[model samples]
Target chain A: MTDVTCFSADCNKSKLFWGLLALGGLVMLSTLSAYFYIEHHGHIVTGMNNQIVWGLPHVFAVFLIVAASGVLNVASIGSVFGKKIYKTRSPLSGLLALTILAGGLAVLVLDLGRSDRIIVAMTHYNFKSIFALNMIFYTGFFAIVGLYLLTLMDRKLKPWSHPVGFLAFLWRLALTTATGSIFGFLVARAGYNSALYAPMFIIYSFAYGLACFLVVQTAMYKWNNIQIDEYVLGRIKNLLAVFVAASLYFTAVLHLTNMYFAKQWDFERFILVEGDTYPMIFWLGQVIVGGIIPLLMIFSPGAAKSPARILIAALLVIVGGHAQMYVTIVGVQAFPLAIFPGYAETSSFFDGVVHPYSPSTLEVMLALGGMATTFLLTTVAVRILKFLPIDKLDQKH
Target chain B: MTASHKPERRDFLKTGAVVAGAAIAPGVLFYGIAQGRAPEEGASSLVRWGMLIDTGKCANGCTACVNACNTENGLSGKTGPQDSQWIRKLNIKHLQTGIEHNLPMLCQHCANPPCVDVCPTGASMKRADGIVLVDRHICIGCRYCMMACPYKARSFVHEPLADQNPDVPRGKGCVEACTFCVQRVDKDQQPACVEACNADGHQAMLFGDLRNPESAIAKAMLAYASVEVRGDLGLNTGVRYQGI
Candidate 1:
C-alpha cells in the first residue's frame, strides 16, 4: 500500500479556496438565521402568492437534486464499467454525491410551507401522486448511495461495491426522471404541461454533474499539490465538451418544438422572450453565458487544454444549468391561467392575477447557505476521513 | 464467504416461509376488521352530502354568501385575490360564442377527486359520508393536491396564520379548501353561506343529502338539469350548478 500525506500542509495558500470557504460559511449562517425567522414569522415572509405558490427555494432544490444525480456518474463509470481512470476517484465522487444530496434535501425541507409536518408526507403515503413517488425514490436513492459509499470505504466489503454502484446509477436516473415528470405530468399549467421535460432533465443531469465534478476535482488537485495527469485531464475535457454541446442541442430542440407546436405560444413566447427576468436569464445567462460560451471554450483547440479556461467553462456550465432550472420551474408559475375569461377580459393584466414573487432576503441567504454547507461538508470529508484516494491509480498502464 | 457454503437451500426455504407469513398477515387482519365493523344488512344510514346552486334564480349583485361565510367563519378580511376562497364568484364565458355567465364556485367534493388521486399523503381525502376535507394535522404540504384540483379550489396557507376561528380547524403547511362547513354539518345545520342565502330570501343555495330521495337537493336535481364544472374529468362532484 502506498503511503499518503496531507497536501493541505504545503498547498493551502490559494486565495480562492479561503474566499470560497468563508463565503460558503457566511451563506450557511445567513440561511440558518432565515430558516428560524420563517419559523417565527411564517411562510408569508417569502414571496409565494396563491397563483405563484412555488418560488426560488423550489428552483434551488430541483437544481441541487439534479446536480447530485449527475455527480454520481464518476462512480457509475468506475464501478459499473470498470474504468481504471475513474476507479481511483470513485470514493471522492461517491462522497460528493452524498454531500450534494444532503444540501438538496435541506433546501427542500426549508421550502415547505409547514416544515414541521414533513413526516406526515412520509408516514401517510399518497399512492396515486407522482410527487409522493418522488419522495420515496429520493429517500431510497440517498440510502443506496450512502451505503455504497460505505462499502467502498471498507476493503472487506469491496466485493459487493460494484453491484451497489450499478444499482445506485440506475436508481439515481429513475429518481431524476421522476422529478422531471412532476412538472411534465401537470396538464393544467401551460409552461409545465409537456412530455419532453423528463428526457430534458436526464440530459441536464449529465451536463451539470460533469461540470460540478470538474470544478471540485480541479480545486482538490490544486489544494493537495497533486498534479492531474495531462492525458486524464484531456479526456475529461473532451467528455465535458460533448456534454455541453448535447445540453445545448436538447435545449434548442425543446424551444423549437414548443414554437413549432404552437399550443402554448402565448405563454412560451412570454417566458422565452417577453416575460420579466426569464427572457434575460434564459437567453443570455443560461444559453450564452452558461451554454454557448462554455461550449466554445471547451471545444476550441487553443483553450480546451488550458486549466484556467477549463475551470471557467465548468463554472459557466454550472451557472447555466441552474439558470435552466429557475426558468423552467419559477418562470412557469409567473403567469396565471386565465380561468375566468369575462373577469380576465374586464380586469387589467395584473388584476385578479397574482404577480407576487420576489425571493426574500432570508430565502436567498438560505439557498446560498445550502451551497456553502455542501462545500464545507465535502472539504471536511476530504481532509478528515481521507475520502479521496491519493495514489490508487498507477501510471504503469 | 464461508456462511454461503453451508445449507444454502434449507436456510433459503426457512427464510422464505417466514417472509411469506409476514406478507399475508396484514391482509388477514384487514379482512377481520372489515367483517367486525360491517354495518347491519339492508340498514342504510349513510349520508351523501351535496350542494345545489341555482345560478338562474341567484341575484348576482348580492354578495350575501360571501358576507355570511366571512361573518360566520370570523374571516379577518385578509383574503386577497391570491388567497383561498371557500366560495368564489366566477364570471365565465364561452370560448367561441362569447356568452358570459356569473356563477359562484366552491369545492366540487368529487366522488373520484383528482386531488385525492394525486395526494401522496392521505391528507386530501373524502370522508365516508362524502365530505371532502383536508386533515391539516397530518398534511405534509407538498401541494400535489393543489395541482390536481381542476376547480383550483385548494390553497396553501403559506404563512403563519392569525385570527383563525378556534372551532374551525386552520394552520400552515397544509392545503385547504371548502369543508362544506363540516363544523355546522355535524350539528345538523346547513353551511353558514347556505343558511345566509336562505335567510336573505334568495334561497339560491340548497344543502342536503343527494342520496336521500326526499331531500330538497335530490328533488332539485330531479326537477332541473344541474351541471358540474369539468364533469368530463369524471369526478362525480357533489357541488352541482343549476342553469350553468
Candidate 2:
C-alpha cells in the first residue's frame, strides 16, 4: 500500500513540464502539416528550385548533426581521458548526443523529394559517390553511439565503457569528416573544393557541441537550485574559447586561400564584396557578431568570471554557426558556373545571373521543428532519468 | 516404301545449300542499315552516339531548335529560373579578343559524367551507347548531380507536370537533362533540334554514331579542327564544336 501511494505521487506532472511539452507538440504538428502540403503540391511552393536545391532545412539539419557528434566529447573526456568532473556528466552527454542526432536526421529525411521512396535509397549502392558513402557513415554512427551510451548508463556494463568510449570518439571524428567531405569533394565548384573542410568542420563541431552542452548544464543546475562548481566552469569556459578561436582561424584560411588563386579571384570577390546579402552574411553575421563579440565576452577582464556572460557568448557562437552555414551552402550556389572561361556568356537559362533564393514559411517551420524536437526530447529524458551531473565528484578522482 | 521415307545425300546437300543462301542473303544486304534496334532489343555498346556542331553555320537568331525541343518534350518553354531547358542557344563574346560567337549548347554527354559520379542512387547513369541520362524511376531528387554538373546542363522539376509528350517520360520531383533525345534516337530519328537545324537549311548540327567511320559527323570531326568546350577538365565530351 505504501509503494502504491508513492508510485502515484511520482506520476504527478508539473505545470512547466506540461507547458513545454505543449509548445513542442504544436510546432511538430505544424512541421508534419507542412511536409504533407509540400508532398501533395510539389517543391514549387518552396523557395528551392533548380538553382538552389537545398534550403533552410539543410542548414538546421547539418548544425544539429555536427553538434550531436561534438556533445560526446564530454563523455570522451570522462571515460577516455579519465577526467573526474566530466565523468559525472557523461550520462547527460551521451543522452544529448542520441536525442540531438535524432532531431537532425528527422529534418534531413523529411526534406527529401521522394520521402516515400527512401527504401530505394537504402537498396541502391553507388560506391564512388560521397553522398552514398555518407549514408553508411550516418547509420554506423547511430549503432556505435547507441552501444556506447548503453555501456555508460548501465552499472553492469560499466567495465566495457573505456573501449566503447574510445571507439565512439573515433567514430564521431569519422562521421564529421564524412559530413565535411560532402562539400569538399565537389570538384566543380569554387567554394567547396578544399582539403581543409574536414578539419574545419571537426573544429566547428567542437565549439558548437560544447556550447550546447554548457547551456543545458546551466539550465539543469538552475532548475534544481544548485550552485555549479567554479573550477569546472572556469576550465570549460577557457576550452570553449580555444574552440571558437580555432574555428575562426580555419574560416580565415579558407577565404585567404581562395583570394590567393588567380582564377578564384572573381569568385572570392563575389562572395566577399559584390554578391547581394552574401558579404553581409559573411562579415557581419559570421565574423563580427558570432566570432569577435563572443571572444571578447569570454576573455575580456572579468567578463569570463560571470556565468551569464559565458552563456551569452555560447548563444552568439551558435547564431554565428547558422550564419556560416548559410554563406557556405546558399552563397556558394548563387554564383554562376564558369562555362566559358575567357568569354562572356548569355542564355535564357539564367546562366550568368545570380540565382536568387528566399525561404518560405514552411521551410522555416520545418527547421524550427528540428530544434523543438531536441528540446522536447531533452526535457522529457531529464525528468524521467537521472541525467544531472553528480556532486562531490571532484574529491573522488 | 523405306526409300520414299528416307532422303538421299544429294537431296540433303541441295536442301542445305538453299537454307544457307536464304539465311545469309538478308544479313549481308542490311549489315549497317539495321543499326537501329527493334523495340525488344536493348541499347548496344557497339554504337557511341555523338554530335558535331559548326558554330559558323548556326544562325544568329534562330529559335527553331529550342522551340522544336519544347514541343517534342512537352516543356513549358518558359525562360524563368524554375523552367526546364533541355537545349539553349548561347551568345558569347571573348573577354580579351573582343570576338563574338553564337552557338547552341546542350548536354556534353561526357564519358566521365560528373552527374553519374555524384548520384547517391545509380539513377543518374550513362547508357551502353555512351548517352548520359537520368533514370527517373529511382531518383530521390537530392540534386547532388545538379551541384556537380560543370556545364549547367541539368534541371530539376519543381511543380507538378501535365500534358507530357507520349514518347517522353518526365514528371515533377526528378532531376532531368538533355538525353540527346534518346526517345527519337531509339526510333532511328534524329534529335528534334538537329532535324530543325537541317530543315532551316543551316545544317549546323550533325548527329551520328561516332564509332562508324563513314558517319558524316565522324568525317567532319576528322576534316575540321573541332574542340570540346572546357576541354581542360578532360571529360572527353561527345559533343564537339568547330569555328567557335
Candidate 3:
C-alpha cells in the first residue's frame, strides 16, 4: 500500500516521458554503432594517434565520474549531518549519484580498446596500479550507496540510514581521492604529478555534483508542477556558491605550486598562455563560464531567487567542468614530454611538438550519449519511485 | 584368429619399430627445437642486457638501423604520426653550441621503468635480464603506459595489421615498444638495429651483457662516460649514450 499520490497524477506526462526515453535510446544506439565501427576499423578511424592517445570521450567520462561523486553530497548532508530538509531530498540524490556513475562508466568501458575483455579487467588485479584500486572503490560505492538508499526508502530500514549514510560519505571521499590520484600518480607527466590533485578533485566533485543536483531538482519540480520553498532553494544555492569558491581556491593553489617549480615553467606557460585551445578554455570556459557566471547567478540578489537562473548557473558549471577536464587530460598529453631538455628535438612521431586532436563525430556522439543515459535513468527512477521531496513549507507557500 | 596367430620375427620387429618410431619422433623433435628456440631455464640476474650508442660514430642520414628495425620487427616502416615505430633516428643540434648529433632512440629499458609501474594489468613488465616488454596478451590498450614513458618510446597499434612476423606477435589495440629484440637476444644474437649498424661500418651501437666486465658494452662503459637521457630521473636505463 504505497502512496500513489506521491507520483505525478497527469497521464499526459507519459507521452513526454516516452518521447524523452526514445531520444535517449536513439543516442545510445548511435553510441553503440560508433563503438562497433571503432572495434572493426580500430583507432585509426578516430582522431586519436600515438601522440594524442586520449581525446574527447575521456573528458566526458572524467567529468561525469567526478560529478557522480559530488551528486552524493546531498544525501550525505541529509543523513550524516542530520539536516531534516535534506533528508527528504536524499532519495533523489542517491538515484542521481547512481545514474550519473552509470553514464560515466559506460563511456569509459565502451572507449576501451578491448571493450570485450571487460571480464578480464574485472578479474585481474595489479595492486600497484591505481586504476585497479579504483575498480574496488567504484564497486563499493554502488553497494554501499544502494544499501544507503534502501535505508532511506524502507520504513524498517530508516533507523539504519544515518549509519549507512556516514559510511557512504567516507566511501565517497575515498572514491574521489582515488579518482584524482589516477592523474596525480603520473610521475613522468609535466602537468599531473601533484599530491594536490586528490583534494582538488574532491572539492571539484562537490561543486559539480551539487550543481548537477540543483539542475535535476529544478527539472523534477518543474515537471511535477511544484515549486520548492524559497528557504530550501536559498540554502542549496548558498552551499553551491561556497563549493564553487573552494574549488576556485584549489585551482589557484595548484597553479601557484606549479609556477613555483622552475622545470614546470614551460608547461605552465603552455597551459596558461601559449596553447590556443587550452588557455582559451581555461580562462573563458572554466573560469568565466563555469566559475564567475555561475557565482553571479547564485549570489546576485535579484537572480538568486529565480529557479530559472539557478538552473542556468548549474548548467554553466557542468559545461565549465567539461572544459577543465579537457585542459587537464588532453592538453597535458598534447604537450611534449621533456625527454631532451637542452636541445630542440625533431622526429616523425611529432616529438617536441604540440599534438593536435579534433573530436570525431563518433566520439562526440558517445559523449552526448553518456549524458542522455544519465537523464533517461534519472527520469525513469523518479517516475516510478517516490524520490521527490515533499516540503511542507513549499506547499504552504 | 589374429590373436591366436604366431607372428614371424620380421613381422614382430616391423610392428615394434612402427610403434617405437611414432612415440620417439615427437620427443626427439621437441627436444631438438626446444634446445634451439627456448631461453635458458631462468633469466640469470647475473646478466644485464644493455646497449651503448656512440654518437661520435653515428652518421647523418643513415637509415641502416631504422630500416633493419622495421624489417626485423615487421613494422610498416611508415614514419607517420599514426604509424608504430619501435625505434627511430633522432637528429639533435645543441641550441647554444650549434653542434649537430645523430642517434637512434628506442626504449631505454630502465631498471625501474615508469611504464611498467603504471600499467594496470602488469602487462608492461621487465624481464630478469632487464629487457622491458609489453605482454600484449594482457595489455587492455589503455595507453596509460604511453603517457608514462619519458622517452616517448612506446606506440599504440592504431590500425589492424597484416603480414606480421609470427615470431614477434603484435595485435591492434595493444601498446608496444622496443623489446630490445628479445627473440634474437635470447639466442646470443645482436638486435637487428645493432647488427645493421655494424654491417653498415658505422659500428655506432654496441649490445652486450653489462654485468660481464669482459663484455664490449661493459668495457666501453669503463672507457667512456655514457649518459642516460633524462639522467636526473635516476632510472638507471640499460641503454646509454656516449657523447650526448
The most accurate candidate by lDDT is 3
lDDT score, candidate 3, position B150: 89
**Ranking of predictions according to lDDT:** 3, 2, 1
Model 1 Cα shift for residue A174 (angstroms): 1.7
1 against 2, candidate with superior lDDT: 2
CAPRI-wise, candidate 3 is medium
**Candidate 1 error regions (>4 Å):** A1-23, A252-263, A338-354, A389-397, B1-46, B81-83, B94-96, B222-226
* TM-score to true structure, per model: 0.84, 0.90, 0.95
DockQ of each: 0.24, 0.64, 0.72
Supply candidate 3's per-residue lDDT for A374: 93
Shift in Å, residue A333, candidate 1: 1.3
How far residue A96's Cα lies from its native spot in candidate 3, in Å, is 1.2
Model 2: per-residue Cα lDDT over B1-244, one tens digit each:
7778567766888899999989998998787667767656778888999999999998888988899898888899998777889889998889999898888888899988988998999999999899999998889888889988888888888878988988788877788889888999988899999999999999999999999999998899999999988898788899999997
Q: Which residue pairs clash in candidate 3?
A: none
| Candidate achieving higher DockQ, 1 or 2 | 2
Q: Rate the local accuracy (lDDT) of all candidates.
A: 0.76, 0.86, 0.88
Stretches of candidate 2 above 4 Å error?
A: A1-13, A391-397, B1-41
Pairs that collide, model 1: A27-A369, A114-B173, A126-B120
How many steric overlaps are in each model, in order? 3, 0, 0
Better of 1 and 3 by lDDT: 3
Candidate 3 i-RMS: 1.1
Candidate 3 chain B weakest lDDT stretch, 10 residues: B36-45
